[model samples]
Structure formats: structure tokens, C-alpha cells
Target: MDFRGQISAEFLLIVSFIVVIVLVFSSIAGPQSQENSIATAAREGATGAISEMSYTNVSMKPMRVTGIKITGGSNRVISISFERPVPPEYRALVINRTVESLLTVSGVKPVNSTTVRLGDRTYTVQI
Candidate 1:
């Protein structure tokens, strides 16, 4: 009886199955984990920016954030836009301290120019 050969073949088959399963699981989990990380970063950044801009300048009445948008694909650029426009002086504070810093900590590179529109005062930052 050649039971030794049969046992070896069964062991090899089980090991290969486990390897395939691990590869499949890794492929499924990789992008999902990245997406979750980006979402967390975006949410935190937006929240911090809103809080900072809320009472940034005591001279003017506290500003209200109308809305926030975070958009991007995995392993690509991420953009965070705040609905309310901030004062010129506070733009640097929001972008540099709140948004950029948070995104950088999450390993995202923010674009150089952060645009503040005229009417809505919307602030957009690309990472």
C-alpha cells in the first residue's frame, strides 16, 4: 500500500488551497482598507477644519459650514471641499494646520493651490 504518496498529495492540495484563499482575501481586503483609511482622514480633516474655521476670527461673527465634500479614488488624489469660504488670513490656517496636516498624517499629499471661490466662499483642497 502506497499510503505515504497519497498523504503527501493531500497535504500539498490543502496547502495550495489555503494559499489561494489567503491571496483572494488579501485582494478583497486591500482596497477596502485603503478606502476606509481615506474616509477616516477626510472626515477628520473636514471636522477639524470646520471647528477651526467656526471661531477662527473673533472680529467677525462665527461662521457656519454649509456643507463638506470628500472625493477621490483609491491610491489616487483626494479632494476635500468646504462649503463656507473663509477669510484670506484663515485660509492658511484651515489648509495648512487642519486639512493638510491631517491628510499628511494619513499619507496623502495635498495639492499646492487651494482655491477659495468668490460667492459661496467654498474652499477646495486637493490631496
Candidate 2:
């Protein structure tokens, strides 16, 4: 083969290879970015629930949290229900709902009583 023709073929092959790599990487990255967004939103929602100091704030439009429900209620016992949707990238996305309150009024210390239900799986955390 002529040297010039060989060089042209090599250049084209390299360019095509680069394009394929970019497309593959971009496709993988797209889903990961979505997952991060959902996770961040969920974390923000949890923080809002704690900082606002009320389940009502979590439901408010200002907070951007959705589906806040009081599944059970009592003076000392309260069951707040909220679901955080998992990112689309996740095949089995988990929805977590937590119920927490101030365990001590004097110190304003939150006694974390959280119940997480992720894709029908239930877990509890106490702090």
C-alpha cells in the first residue's frame, strides 16, 4: 500500500475509535449524573425535615419534598411517612421514609427514630 493512503486510513480509524469511546462514556455518565441528583435531593429532604423541626415543613412546597404523610399520630408517638424516589440509573431504586423528633426538650437533641422502607424492605435506625 502507498504510505500516504496508509496514513489516511490510520487517521480515520483513530478518529472513529475516539468517537465510539466518547459515546460509550457519555451514555454511562448520563445515568450516574441522574442518580447523584436523586440522592442529593433525598439527602436535602432529610436535612429539611430535621432542620425545619416539623413534618409539615417537609410537605410544604418551599421544601420541595413530596408525599409527606402522618401515618400515625400521638403526643409522644408520631409516625411520619415520606418517600424519596431513587435515581433512574438504579435498577432497584429504594424509597426511604424516616420518623424522628426531639427526644429531649431541654437540650433540643434529636432522638433519631428513623424507619426506612426501600423497595418493600423495612429497616429502622435509632440514635
Per-residue lDDT tens digits for candidate 1, residues 1-127, read 6587998899999999999999999999975675565445555765666576665545654544444344432223345455555667666665555445445543444444453221222234552
Return the clash pairs for model 2, or none.
Answer: none
Model 2 CA deviation exceeding 4 Å by range: 54-127
For each candidate, how many residue pairs have backbone atoms clashing (under 3 Å)?
1, 0
TM-score of 1: 0.58
lDDT of 2: 0.39
Off by over 4 Å in 1: 58-102, 105-107, 114-127
lDDT of 1: 0.54
Candidate 2 residue lDDT tens string, 1-127: 4587888899999999999999999999975563344334444544554444334444433323443222222112222223443223321122222222221112223323344332222323211
TM-score of each: 0.58, 0.42
